[model samples]
Target: MTRRVPFAWFARNILVGTLLGGAYGAIHDQVSWSISPEYFTKFKFEQFAWAEIGLEPRLAASWIGFLATWWAGAIAAYAVCRMAFRHAFQDGASSWPLGRVVRRLLAVLMVAMAGGGCGFAYARMRAQDVERLWGGWRTYAGVQDLEAFATVGSIHNFGYAGALLGIVLVAVHIKVKGRVDRSSPQSLPPPGR
Candidate 1:
């Protein structure tokens, strides 16, 4: 019978997964920001910065967008863990209870998503600062715009990547342990006659 998820397990998994996801998101945000230009003068994408329109609207949109993206990443992470736990980690001697695993995975996903959201918030805040410094994307338009967009996108992407990576890692571990097969052992040859 499948076992129920324990409260402690849920708490621990969420704490750890969230921390890991958040870290990845932050690092990715930094890298992307460094590479992308604020204004795509060559592409006219700067016209879409929204900051050029109104400060309050842009600020509100940024927050809403960031939250949505981060929540998505969290859900993705949780789904990945659930699939891994149910299909890959089940039926092993050391296997956790199905319910407990599900609970823990859910917790982890939620925490991870929260972290992703925080990362986005930080990125958007930085973007706002960039906008303020450059006077609405004219002076350092391309660079600042690119950095801001990149920062938010990168963090969201990284959160998803981390969850996917976690799935792969767990799957590999199950494979290594030969836990995928649980069929009854073949009968020995007539007691070695």
Candidate 2:
């Protein structure tokens, strides 16, 4: 059995998490745009139907970013909070503080960002091979823009991979930390009846 978590805290975390995720997605889209404007102008704009909206490209990209990722953040936060409260229960704590939970989740964000960077680097390094082989984007735009489109796509794809990695890492860390706490002398009962 586990201690109870207040519904208020749960709701707050969900709201915060959604906002955090949306902000990350928006910022990421902006950076991706900087890397390759063609990546959005030729592909994502049409995919999101933002092309007809007539907004500036950067604003459109940011909106798409928020729309694409806000739910992801909320989902991730919900799962993480469950694990965290469970961890607190195992550690004999009354509750897991919200601030610490946010900090821990920030680590997940950082890991995902790093993964996206690695993806961008990897795509650029292998541009010759990846672009030549992945002709999927050819129908969307001219060949001249293939490299940019492919690289940005790689960034988005790898970011998801990174988020997965972060979740795993955080789970493992929570489990290990709980074990260490359980085994500590302070967690033991005194000998005398």
Candidate 3:
């Protein structure tokens, strides 16, 4: 029979998983940086130029703060997952293996990516609205802006890549954890025994 895990173990596992996942997400952000492409200059994009914004310390601070925001997002997501599955990892129950925990973690990532993709698509459809809001008087009013932002391209690439990566990671994790033997309550031990 598999050994039981204490309530404290569950708490610890959740906390550690959240922190680790948050860190992983943070690292991911740093890996995907790309410079603005030349195409942006050809179109009526002079108004949105970074040089016009005048780089300021506050801007730098806010950008840095974005990283913390990303970390918090990741941590909160994992925490929510743990809370949602609290009943499954109760004290006196068989402790989940590391591989199982990893599988769950990856599963969450995959779901998040899928959700993000939907959001991305929605955001894309409304991209012109977003540009209008940000551009104000500086927007290209007459001609159709053909030159696309490089960031848009990267966003598309990352969206698909993130989904694929999430699936692969989840698959590997689940494979290592093995499959559920049955669907009955018998699959789990009797409570309080």
Candidate 4:
């Protein structure tokens, strides 16, 4: 039987994952803000009540980003630790380690970012439709440039969807790696770990 995630360190892994996800979200939201500040000014600021607190729009948006996605990282870490570390041991050898787990989850972050970028591009290309069809379109009627606001919203939407998909993909990848390593007799733990 293979070793599961080392219980002692999994909490640390979850913390790192949560922080990383927050950073990604904050950065992504900054980009979205750059593209359409109204997305934050008219929508997110109010939704998060930062506008009421009189915080700077950009700062508020960044906080919103972090709050929105930090949990995603924790979930991702748990899934990765469970799936990938089960393959950690085989034939009295340990293969996957916590460091490797972090790296793999970072790959998941990249995949999610890629999806966000694509969503931004697609929404930009169809800005008019996005603005018209966005669920909050009427709520944001006062927005100076409704299309830009909606495009940014679409970017956020696509990013969340992408993160979910990215996790699934990463899970499949690690599972395949587990299967491959299971067949080999060479999977071994690091010398000092």
User: Candidate 1, residues 1-193: lDDT per residue as tens digits?
Assistant: 2454444644444444454444444444344334443312322234345534443432434333343334444444455445544554444324554355444444545554554566566666777564554344444433434555545454555556555554555445545443434332532234656
Tens-digit per-residue lDDT, 19-119, candidate 3:
64555444433322222222233321343344343534334322332433344344533443343244343333344555556556666566545544554
Give the 10-residue window scoring lowest on summed lDDT in candidate 3. Answer: 31-40
TM-score of each model, paired residue for residue: 0.38, 0.86, 0.43, 0.84
lDDT score, candidate 2: 0.79
Q: Which ten residues in a row have the lowest lDDT in candidate 1?
A: 37-46
**On lDDT, who's better, 1 or 2?**
2
Candidate 3 all-Cα RMSD:
9.2
* Order by lDDT, highest first: 2, 4, 1, 3
List, residue by residue over 111-130, the lDDT tens digit for candidate 2.
88989999999888988886
**What TM value does model 2 have?**
0.86
lDDT of 1 at 77: 43
TM-score attained by model 4 = 0.84
Q: Residue 137, candidate 3: how far off, in angstroms?
A: 12
lDDT (C-alpha, whole model) for all candidates: 0.46, 0.79, 0.44, 0.76
Residue-pair clashes per prediction, in order, are 13, 0, 0, 0
